[model samples]
Target chain A: MATMTIAKAITSGLRAVLADDPKTLIMGEDIGKLGGVYRVTEGLQAEFGADRVVDTPLAESGILGTAIGLSFRGYRPICEIQFDGFVFPAFNQITTQLAKIRSRSSGMLSAPVVIRIPYGGGIGSIEHHSESPEALFAHTAGLRIITPSNPHDAYWMTQQAVACQDPVIIFEPKRRYWLKGEVDTESAGRDAFSAQVVREGTDVTIVAYGPLVPVALAAAEAAQEDGNSVEVIDLRSISPIDFDTVTASVEKTGRLIVTHEAPTFGGIGGEIAARVAERAFLSMEAPVLRVGGFHMPYPLAKVEEQYLPDIDRLLEALDRSLAY
Target chain B: MGAEHLPASEFDIEELEQSLVTSDPADAPPLVQLMAPDGSLREDTKYGHYAAHLDGEALRAMYRDMALVRRFDQEATALQRQGQLLLWPPLLGQEAAQIGSGTALQAQDYVFPTYREHGVALTRGLELSKVLRLFRGVSNGGWDPRESNFHLYTLVLAAQSLHAVGYAMGVQRDGDDAVTVAYFGDGASSEGDVHESMVFAASNQSPVVFFCQNNHWAISVPTEVQSRIPLSNRASGYGFPGVRVDGNDVVAVHAVTRWALERARSGKGPVLIEAFTYRMSAHTTADDPTKYRELAEEEKWRERDPLLRLERYLRSTNTAGQDFFDQIAAEADKLAASTRADVLAMEAPDFEDHFANVYAEPHPLIREELEWHRQYQAGFAEETAGQAEGEAR
Candidate 1:
């Protein structure tokens, strides 16, 4: 058990995985000597040496492509894509090679690779820094995408992603990287792929992932002031989504509000809304609503907050759900 | 004279001949010729070393693989015309280049391919229906790479090259004898990934083979724009031996690939083999070759067709009679029909499949999303039911 920020928790988790498995390696640009731009991989290279903690060239595609090849050769490589927007250059390798290699191999080989990217808006970053491309990866078959909203999950899920046989895309909310929590290092509880109920309520179910999970929790806290109990669910896994928890909460609440920083059209929120309408239609007292980014490229830094789903946007969606 | 300014010395031909088939190091540049197009033996060369490896039946099998792959290429073009597929990249004349290098790989060796290597995919044992699904927009990749030791088909040009080099590095780290072969077109030779792959492979001595099929075009761009010198000459700058082979010659491709593989396995390092072939069709079904290149260029390549060259060589040697040719043709037709049937029979993937394999362990957000989707779906069903009840009432 330890109290730490999400950044520290992730580093600790990486250290533990490296210690446990000899084959586990961490490779990324600036990860070796610079300890990553966010320092999530701080001190890992010095502790593990350059062989295990590699500082590769400034090539995202090369990092991921190599990681796939390494995974094929029985080494579990955890690749860091540096930033959310930077991951697109490697998207071809991820979608075409890493994701499909498993099923395309028809169970003959398991990729066992983890691609870590710092995602979402709110940091007042430049263009291409706060985009959400989770829907793209989630839509692709044979890939497992997970994002941790807190320190506890950041610690546990990082290890779980490293251990999983399939290639896992672990999206860490860059904005929430500093958020602190108490993490039980010994017990990761359920696998990192399942969703976690962060707050218990009965009035409405709020679903959010990555950075939006913390925003949803804040909204739940604020909603308590109005005496409207909000159930908040942190979506740990984006693909192979844990629907059981979501449906159970929706069944109890009778209303749902899904939130994400990505565009609403064909977003993971859309997928959730359609699924809920199919399975929990009779239990719904109000129509499911979504709070998401607009159908535009993630805007420049100045107006990014407006482009991202914040507590206010989530609360607004909650109010809409209540009206429905 | 400065070391750099020295004229490139002519390679010793005698040394090249002695080490042509054997893995021994000769003073010559790597064995660049094992079988000439004329079917006549190189008198000064040690052709006996590769004689046992080439059989009449095997040559015919290579020919059949090329013909069948070309037929599928034609069918895919037709399907795209009929709106069955959104796009198709045809490998009409580069059959021998793909099949030869593909067959050269051992069971353990891995392959990294670009999108146009459908012939390579067939040789790697991928199902035809699975390959079609990618173009049909049903899936991003239709088959597994680990089963055949073949990576997924990359659409982005030359991206797979870096992956191959990285995988080759892993092979070195694991102390494995397996080498990785990266298949890319001449246009990809100009991409940054290809250069990075060569540099990394050279620096690390990663066991990789760069198999460049110089089919003369990258969409609208010609080969000259991509390279001023021959593509093989580019490898010398990367600190590895490079060879040019008649890409249309299956026997030559096999020999060169086998030699490169042997060198890589023996820890001799990487090699680049440029298969100088031609693309008989458009780059993809969406492309129009007539808009860019002249008809004469196409006609000239047609005369040196890879399939015809092999057929002529086999016939001149009495290795393939009419009966053998007919049998192969029948087999190829059956393969095409079976492939079509498989494509038609492929089941539409289930909706839940989208949520199933994102991670080895269950993710909380994914669980929530999946549950949310179920509820969302159920709501629609309920609405439908209520509407039906209202109508009945």
Candidate 2:
């Protein structure tokens, strides 16, 4: 076991996997010499060599398309999309080719390719650098989406995504990259789709994922001070959500609030709310409330805080759900 | 005077024939041809070595593959017209391009084909009937690429070119000599995906071949609309070799593709092959060619029919007896009958199967959706019960 930042844990996990598997390859722009903008892939190119940690051309479509082909050749390619906003260039390949290849081939072939995208807001970064595109992938079929909140989950979830036969998109919360936690190097920490109840309480359940996890925890602590017991759930897997866990929690609490940095309209929170309503409708004390960014393009740094869901916003949603 | 007011000149058959193959007359790139339209064997010194392996046996086999593929393509079009299939993309005039380039590859080599490579699928040994499953709307992917090392047909324009480059890169890293080839149309050359793939292939020196069948049309748009210059010439800008072959001539196509694959396999990097053929049929079964193209232009391409050229060569060489030609015709018929039977026999997949393989692992969303579907299906039970009661009354 080692204590490391979420970024280091991910690097360690990727290193462990790349060292273990000869077929696994790392490819992206600036991933080789620069070791990634966040330095998560630092020291890896030195260890793995250029063949393993490849610095691709400045084209996202080329990166993903080629990764799909490499997957056909039985190579597990880990493609790094430099930023969340830049993933749109490869959207056609990711959605049409990588996502559909397995089902299209009737399961004879699978693209065990992991597309790593550093997503979400709160870093006060420039436009296109800080945007949450999870809902886009989560809404898409034939894609497995996962996001980890802490180092332990980050380290393990990455390996799990690589092990997955289908195309897995890892939406790493860029703002949470420096958050440190204990990660087990001896084994994988948890399943990719399982949601963890980070904080346990009774009155209401606040579900969050990626960067919003810290906000959820802070909101839970604030709610405790306000004399309301609010449970916080980290949705590790955004696609095949751990609805059983969420349903159980919502049933016990009889209230739920889903939060994220993505737009409130047609976001993943809406899907979670709908699913929870379907499964635990009678148990709900009120309509599932959501706390997220407004329905607009992610604003620039100066007003990003107001656009993003913070502890105040989470608590407000929680208080509303509980008051019902 | 305007051409509409002036009397037309008497059309000369020989002049028209000369014009079709001449670069100056059509303002098109000169096509690399091995066998002339008259079936006479003429050698091009540059590409002769690649075709050295094409003996009588190889020629006969290529002819057989092309014949059967054409028959199967016709049957699929008929099926679509009969409402059995949702749609069909006919690989009508470019048989030589598909069969020759497809057959030239070694077993270890892989192909990424666009939606219209029916002949390539046949050459690669996928069931001719299985190819119709996608058009029939029963399967998401028509056949397993693993079985033949020919990937599923990509409907998205030029997407497969990137995949092919990537696969070729993989082959290079593995220290293997296998090549990867992607097949797309002339119009697909305009896609950014193709440009990116070429750039990546050139930079990495990836072992890939971009095989573009310039069949002269992309639905209603002509090939000229896609590129002002020859599509092959674009490869030079990408820093790679490019060759324009007579797509209607199977012998030349096989030789050219072999040469490109050799370059790629030997780690010389990617090559672009422009197969100058024409689309003899409509873009697909659903299209109206009469609205977009001229009958006179269609007649010009018909005179240079790929199958007729091959048949002429076989006869002029005395390589195939009349009985051999008869056997090929019989085989094509048998293929059509069997393919039609297989297509007719194919049942629609269970509705639940749609939700089954969305994820390799069982997904809760899929499960929830499947369950909801089950209840929705159960909603029809009361109607059946009421019908039974009415009968009893």
Candidate 3:
């Protein structure tokens, strides 16, 4: 086990997949020579050569559309959309084509493609850079949407996503790229679609994903001080969410507070809340409260923190649930 | 008199037809056509190389493919009205255009289609029930492309053209003789991807056939809005051969598509075939053509219907008898009934089925979510049990 930043873990994960499969190729704008804008793909071009580590044109749609073509031709392509906002150009390819290709073909063609996007606000980024479009991909059928909260899961999940037969949308929290954690490369389990309970408690269950996992952990830690034991679950897979861990935690805690940086309306949080309400009605101490951004679009950088759900807001929601 | 009317100088129909058959640059006016609209063959046509490829059986099969597709299309439209389907894109008048090109391909070839290519999909062996799922709102895609070598129906206009070009590039990489055909409408010709596809196909010398069905109207938007010149001429600018075929003429479509596919297979790059077809029905079950266009224009096109033209040709040649026509009609009716039954009987996909294919490996979050749903559903069962006990008390 070694301590590494999320970027390093992702680099290592990509390296592992490349080493494992000769057919695996990574393509994106600046991903080959510059090692990606965030350098997550650093050293891959040199190690894999130009053919495998391709530097595509500046078109997001072109990148994804070509990736689909490549996938159809028996190559597993891991495409990186430079940033969250930039993914929209490729949205048609990803949602209309990549997502539906497998089911559309009635399982004849499997688009074992991974679309990696650096998402969420809080790095003080401009417009289009900070938006969360997970809900859009999740809403579409035949696409698996997942995000890693830390370096360890990032390392394991990225490899698992590459190996998966279906197209996987892997959203890495851009702001959390620098955050470091001990990644047990040897013991990093290869579970691709399940949720994990990071910190266990009994009073309330706090569900978060991607960038908001650390915030939820912090909120849980703070809630512990006030004699409230909060169980925090990291939703690694956003779509087809691992509801078992969530429901078990909710059943034990009897209260739930879901959090995310994306808007509350039609968010993955709403799906979790609705599911929990139906499943754990008797066990719930209070209605599932969601700690998320406003229904409006992601705000300006100055007020992004206010718009995003943080430890304070999450803890407050926990307090309200405890009061009930 | 209206925006629809253009001066005589804008388009010379005779000159365009003459240009279609021959490669003589001096005599070839920008477009290519080998057959006249009145079912007359043109002299000085460049399609001699492909004339031997079409036989009696092949021609009849192409006609049968079109007729069967038209019947299924009418059934689908009726189904939409009956509320069995959410919507249906009627390819009513464009049968000859699709079947001509669709039947021209080898079994190993790939086709990237826009949503309304029901004729093409049928030729590729896609079951009618599978196509129904997409319109029934039960599934996004009705069939797999790999099995039949046909790509899924792309709904986002001309995006499939780029996909086809990319696939053709892959075909070139594999050193394969298989070609790819991209089917789209004139409205799709306006999209950036279509232009990009042409450029890429030309630059790469990729084996692709860009078959554009100029069905006149793209929803409420007419062909005039999509292009200033004919759609076929746009390919010349991209450094490839472009031809405008009488889309209603099955013979023209077959000859042109066969030539294009053969050219692609032999590494001559891409060829654009603009089939001058007309949309005989509304764009979809939801669209009202009367609201946007004049009814008189539709009636005029109705007289030159592709099916009728083919039937006339078949009868004049003494090729199709009453028994053969009746047999095809019966087959079409049987197919429609079975398709409707199969579609209506399709069970709603299992909720857990959603989690199965998201990833090849089990995702931790999805596992938890499935468990959560199970527990949640169990709670409902517990409530039902409690309700039963309460009634007993």
Best by DockQ: 2
lDDT tens readout by residue for model 1, B1-393: 001222344356665566645332322343354455565433214323543477888888888889889888877777788877889888899998899889888888999989888888888888765788888876666776778887777777887788788788788777778999999989999987788788767766779999999998888899889877788878888788888877887777777788888888888788999998898999888889899999999998888787888887788899888888888788777876776776666666777766665444445555777998999999999999999999999
What does the lDDT read for residue B355 in candidate 1? 65
Question: How many angstroms is residue A220 displaced in model 2 relative to the true structure, after the best TM-score fit?
Answer: 1.7
When summed lDDT is taken over every stretch of 10 residues in candidate 2 chain A, the lowest stretch is A315-324
What is the Cα-based TM-score of model 1? 0.74
Worst 10 residues of 1 chain A by lDDT: A100-109
Shift of residue B2 alpha carbon in model 3, Å: 47
Q: Model 1's chain B TM-score?
A: 0.87
The alpha-carbon lDDT assigned to residue A155 of candidate 1 equals 94
Alpha-carbon deviation at B22 in model 2, angstroms:
25
Residue A101 error, candidate 2, Å: 1.7
Error of 1 at B373 (Å): 15
| Ranking of all predicted structures according to lDDT, beginning with the best and ending with the worst | 2, 3, 1
Clashing pairs in 2: A104-B141
- Off by more than 4 A, model 1: A103-109, A223-228, A263-266, A277-324, B1-36, B40-107, B113-163, B187-196, B199-203, B217-221, B225-229, B236-241, B249-255, B280-299, B302-393
Report how far off residue B76 is in candidate 3 (Å): 6.3
Worst 10 residues of 2 chain B by lDDT: B1-10
The 0-to-1 C-alpha lDDT of every candidate, in the order given, reads 0.82, 0.88, 0.83
